[model samples]
Target: MENTVLIKNATVLPFTRQANGSLNLEPQIADVLIEGDRIAQVAPAIESAPPSASVIDAANHLLIPGFVNAHAHSMEILEKGNHEASPLELWMLYTYPPLQSQHLDARLCYLRTLIGAMEMVKYGGTTIQDDLLELPYVTPEIFDAVAQAYVDVGMRVSLSLHTINQPLHHTVPYLSDFLPADVKQDLEAAQGLSDDAWVDLFRQVYQKWQGYRGLVTTVLAPSASQRVTPDLMHRIATLSEEYDVPIHTHLLETKTQAITGPELYGESVVAYAKRHGILTHRTAIAHGVWLSTQDIELIAEAGATVIHNVVSNHRLCSGIAPIRELMDAGVNIALGSDGMSSNDSFNLFDVIKAAGLVHSAMDTSYDRYPKAADILKWATYGGARSALLHNEIGAIAPGMKADLVLYDLNTLSFTPRYQLPIHLVYAENGSSIRKVFINGQLVVDQGRVLTVNEADIVAELQDRLPEYAVHRKQILQQAERIRPAVEKMLSTAVSQSLSIHRFSRPLHYVS
Candidate 1:
């Protein structure tokens, strides 16, 4: 007996690629038939449906494929709105402080991940590439808890043990020179596992948690190029090749980081990764904001993906990514909310709108600005490619996974809608999302989640906040001790010359 659900009389937006390599989206009133976990049919009319099939009337509704969040960090879910606009380097010290002593309980990890997962699913996000990292190091229990949250909520997740093997001073340029002897000693004492131990940690977690629910899978995340050793990168590459999984890593996201490649590796980070076999079609680079023209070429040549975190970039003052250049160079672009602490939300609708508008300043010609259709494509198809699920997900068509979002046409966002794709990019904010289905299962309906108890999770999070606040203050206190020195490092790096600049204005003349 096959399970089936038939959604009737909805305006279906099926994405089709044209001969020119652009997406063709045609919205037609149709019925979508889901057989088990896959879409069986999408047509103007379905004359026959199984007697036991469930049916929903979707008149005046717009059906589209759910958004794929190509890159994110579930670990930062609890840190939302805790900081103001700051440089990435300075912001990281507080959010990911090295001197932290406590580890989050596994149950707390589950609850925190659920909070983000619930927000994502409610807001039309069906898939996430979560580069989840735990401070100090990741453990099997913590990894399982996070993975289980996504499974329990019925959303697809590509989970990675996001880690950095290199010492703190080695990752950021000029950090050792700026660090006081006492601070340096404390950081060295707090250093995490060795390279080989981190590899074993990944293997232990991957073997147990991979394919847990056919929706949760593991990825190789080495944190960043400058933050990892050649040995670790090679090991990650080997594992990636052996499993055919995606590699999610951060690249140059800020001006300070832009100087890191030439400062540390004598080349761009992309070239460094290529030398280590880490740059491949399966590689998905998060935040290539400071990549050079040559770096972009190398990424394109290797068939790698660069996820554009537009909202986070602006929030952290990281600078705009060369999305137009990347697209022109044949690099696939995807969108990411980045982290809760940075973007402050899990809504891809916000990311979509921001991504559509942020690139206009990149060029004077309007023709070069991002198209609403292209932005939607990046959020869906490009993200699926980044997640290594291009063949299985990212489209609303026969043989695609039954992950879909139905937006109410009567909502204010669509009330006299001129163009639906445009509204989805420029106007919509997930408020009109009436129903969301993942893997043929209805997880969100009429602004409510069906899979988990949001109330309970919210209550638990609130209950733990007092204690959490204490730890946060302590972390901030520790970070404040090094704030002066870190600011100096940032100023020094940004003041240095680079082949390209991503800032809105020339940084050299700032003072």
Candidate 2:
């Protein structure tokens, strides 16, 4: 960040909201001047540069604000592609046991997060909201290891502690009824961390690594509504108000979640969060896949942001989120790469395409579909808002932090290009990202990370993966033992009446 850098003659996509509330994806050719960690100016001609300024001749390049990934799970990078096409309930059972088993070493946790951050930076992602969980319980030392990984890899992160206090049998609707006594006993014994213990852990993390190297931040993440008690939610809300940090939560990722409210608490899950005083402008709700019209209105009124994880929703058989309705209701929409365990990739480029194309299938009206510009907006500035960095990182104007990316317009995806936004959303996969600058420091040049040793990191994982797989044998077996009962629990819950239909196919029509 010490040296000034000048990007010459790059075609830039300036994000602007239209008077009609639509996205304007207009491009302009300009030279960008970077002075230290912030943009100095952007114009047709930026004349004055110091002698040592780095010059990038971008004659035909697409310069965009580095992607702000609104949602992610860095801890799950090691567990990608582990679960095959399972719903949220079953997927949880499949993924969480190893963490509970205490077989995952702290070094493995660091490697997991480092590799994920590498992928994100390589794919032009500059910031992420990582809702990480340390199985069995969360500790400051273990959480700080993941934070150090992000710091070393040069990615801005909102490191959320995604811990659950409620027992397994109590997390879902009548899950205890299907499991045997031995399994029930196991669930009770493996309650992970207590509510108070988690609170102390959050305080420890907040004190130790909230703003390390100006890249890492913290968020209060109570795993989900059914998984965390109301009193704990209030505590988190109080902390949020005191610290003024972003609040992250998951709501209605599946049809079962959409019905959990009335069946358990006689309200919508969204209503339950609202009543607990958890909904606020600082709050970002992930996976609004099953939100009703009223729920959308409530979110709008609360000034909350709905994070759309399109890839995970589709991969897990979670139904499509109503982006059209949410946008129409004036709720700021953002995109996320949920977790490598579900998404299997940290590439926000693919997420953009999924966001662009998925909503069109639900509505026949062409105008109701998400525009390419709209999707790009979500990936950049909308995500900035989600991470509570909207004032700093998402835009490329003068005085903003110099987080930007240079994409090769010469690639086949952009070669013989039509509209830039359309091609970017429909075809690009981040392979053409030539350079990435975070805080005006060039961390990625020519498709490789410079901040960390990429080759050694990859080789280490390759060598250790087999040993890790052998170690995971027991945990996978335990997940298999509970899988059938959870499947039964899902079947039973699907029959409970709900006023909304989020799934593409109905299980059993009440009508």
Query: By TM-score, who's the top model here?
Result: 1
Give the per-residue lDDT digits (tens) of candidate 1, residues 1-511.
6669999999988875668867768788999999998999988899788888899899999999999999899989989988898888888888888776677788888988999999999999999999988888887788889999999999999999888766678788888998899988887788677778877977887788777766888998988988888888999999898888889999889888778888888888879889988999999999999888898899999999999999999988888899988999999999999999899999998899999888887768998898998999999999999988887888888999999999999989997877899988888899999999998889999999999989989999889878778878888898987887788887788788776778878643221
Measured with C-alpha atoms, the lDDT of residue 367 in candidate 2 is: 76
lDDT of 2 by residue, 1-511 (tens): 3769999999987564568755557889999999988899999887898878989999899998989889888767888877687677778766677236563677777888889999999999999899987677666667878899988987888899886777777767767888888888877777567778887888888888887777888999988777788998899889899989888999988888876777789888889998887889999999998899989999999999999999999888888898999988989989999998899999999899999988888867997788888898899878888888888888778888889999999999898978999988998999889999998889899998999998898888888888778767777788887877777888888887777777787654221
lDDT of each: 0.88, 0.85
Regions of candidate 2 where Cα sits further than 4 Å from its true position: 16-24, 507-511
The number of clashing residue pairs in model 2 is: 0
Q: In model 1, which regions exceed 4 Å deviation?
A: 507-511
The CA lDDT at 103 in model 1 is: 78
| TM-score for each candidate, following the candidate numbering | 0.97, 0.96
TM-score of 1: 0.97
